[model samples]
Target: MSTTSDPAALSQETEQRPGAKTRVGGLNQHQMQEEDDIETVDYKMVTFSLAGKDYGIDILKIKEIAKFSSFTYVPNAPPFVSGVYNLRGDIISIIDLRVMFNLPAERKPEGSAEDGLILRLDELMIGVVVDSIDKVVGIVSSRIQPPHPIFGDVNIQYISGVVEKDGRLYIILDVDRIFAKGKSTTEEAESLSAVVAPETSAASDNIDELKQQTIPGLDGQSSGKNEEELDLEFIREGLGTFRGFYPDGIADSWLHRRYSEWRAERKKQGLDVQLTGEDDADNFMRTFFSPYSNRFLGEDYVEAVKAVLPEEVSKNISVWNPGCGKGYETYSLATVLRMRYPGHILKIWAGDNDLLSISTAPNLVFGADAVPTLYEPYLVEAKNGYSFSSEIKDAILFEYHDVTHTSTVPDIDIIVARDLMSFLHPKQQASVFNEFSQKTSTGALLIVGQNEHVPESQDWQHVGTSVVNAYRRL
Candidate 1:
């Protein structure tokens, strides 16, 4: 049978088959069942255009849709391999689908980004560059007919199936088959290798020169000031590139110390010292965060924080907690502050750049077992779990706000920005510190990360013990 763009024509053709009912008003049980099966949509696909033809991939395979450009070039890669791209923190390989299928691709202007889909294939995340991304289309899985050689421009083996919807014929692609390993053909195997090879090879190859320059002690004596000041510079860049973490100002000392530890550990394991990927970058900075980060504060941590609180403050205590992820740290701080100053009117402006985290912070619930005993006084039992009582919850406000941008928060008595400054660039860190200085008054308390130190200034005095890295605004 010939393929047609009209779904109605295809339906009529199916009805004309042997034993199919041709009645208009009166339909048989078999015809009614067939119609019901066709109407039931069980599969969804993210549709896109390839060389002016409609195509689709299973929505379950897609991680996200993005439009990005300027991927880092990999040497000696396959012709179809578009250079690798930094997807947030992870380094993912990019493939040009048009080039892979030998289809005519539209020439884009210089530095223009192409539309792509990030696919989560097993443990790997790969981005495929396509002509244009269309809307998601849902259709009955039963309606998808077997793919024929005449239906698609690419190889019939790569096409999973074909389905007609809204006068359009969509060729469904089998991504697993296309990118699978150990293909029968030599050419196909090589192509598959090109996709997975970057996970081990490309990252190391890209930073080989930096690795060579790095010495055991990380002293910059080799190049006589011509090279990087320290071997940690490369790690710093990788952190910024892969994890958006910058080790400047308050984090500089920790970065240096962590480099020594990282190098020693890698040597003990007989592994390369350089941070080759996002996983390595994360491992390198694992110990840099404060205790109980992104979780409820424990008894020890709550006591350590309370010890740093000033003896005297105004009746109306205003606090600014930036990077308050999911309001865990915020709720923990609220409980601590309530214990510290029970009579004062507590107001906390908790802000985070993550929209999902901030949006759900107000209604966050925790299991009875998960919540610490320190928060029992302020806890309210819910149907599913326990949430903060009105006395604790009503005192804080969560907003989806970027810390780098201008905020309308009032003058603060305490600023809880633990491990937040290190993630920003040097210029951004300076700007934020300047804002902190302006927003806070004298004798106000400031809490930072364990490894981080506030930029040494006469205006701020170190008041924290070894357990807490805090300063009082002078």
Candidate 2:
């Protein structure tokens, strides 16, 4: 009539029972119970090693596993704090578990990356560095034994439990308790949340305050030129920090115009004009992209692009399309080019930094209704859905490439890089522009984002209409 939570006690009970091994359907009671336990694997842990000992965290808490180095060092942070890393675009603080637990760690060579697990703790994302990452281990929840002081080098409070599987003993870590703010025994432990989450918030607030301040001139009114310039500078910095959008010579004119609009809109809403966070920065620059960015180009957009096409061109038209995400924009452009010059041999070198997107782009398929009418001529019905014709598919070479690197694409007649320059560093933007100038001859067309503008130079002429921001090398 009595029940126990201990697995050892239950096993002992099974041993004491009479006919415990009596077979039913060629399997004993204990053997069947073992199979049932195996089938009920509800808990999954991403197992890893720290200082030669196996440790695990709940799989649900893991966002991803990554290996990267050169984290941007924070000015004042705890010794356990590795630094901040830009995961794609969102910045996350990195913590070294070995350092936090006061354990010996393998010293990686300078600039060498360490294994890391990005954890999604509530709304905050943090990266934890470890010695090595192992495979995922799934076991029954009831098999986990209570944490003991002698089980792991980590504090008992941080250790959730210990589980043994295949001769490997894993120390389960309660990340919630480890990262919980104001609930730790020591001041250093309590500051983990403060260092990771609140510090970023405070930095964002400081940026907002710096942008909101208006310096007064001799006449008592705010200094229009200096204040506006200061606000613009902050906006540029925020765009780069929050979203990696660098508005330098490439998007300077559009940035100025957008700043005026953002200021007026914020004033009308009685809110500060400064970008507060990622969401605020996104809202400020929402109208900066072209009409159809990630999707197929619309009918009007195709016509507008076609209108800007040069009247006379060579028989072999070579085009370079960077940031060709999922090949939607590339396919759209290819369709337009094919229609614009049917007799010309079209070749498009499409490049994107996203490997998944670039790999799947060549095999992109869509329903007939999903694409614009302009793409109807190139549609070929397949088992799954309609895909581009062989001619259109063969015309493009989708490669995983970053535009900041040296491009092997031959001399280009046209470059379609919309909404790409603003996301790169200023120096990178300058380098890409220089490449464009170098690879292109006179009358080569250059199409950028709607809000972006090519810098004024004798080598390039502004030939864009109100619909498209384009230029021509002169």
Each prediction's number of clashing residue pairs: 0, 0
Q: Give a tens-digit lDDT track for model 2, residues 387-414.
A: 9999999999999999989898876889
What tens-digit string does per-residue lDDT give for candidate 1 at 351-432? 9999988898999998988878988989999878999999999999999999999998867889999999988776577668
- Model 2 segments more than 4 A misplaced: 1-228
Model 1: CA > 4 A from native: 1-230
In candidate 2, residue 168 scores what lDDT?
95
Please give the range of 10 consecutive residues that has the lowest summed lDDT in model 2: 1-10
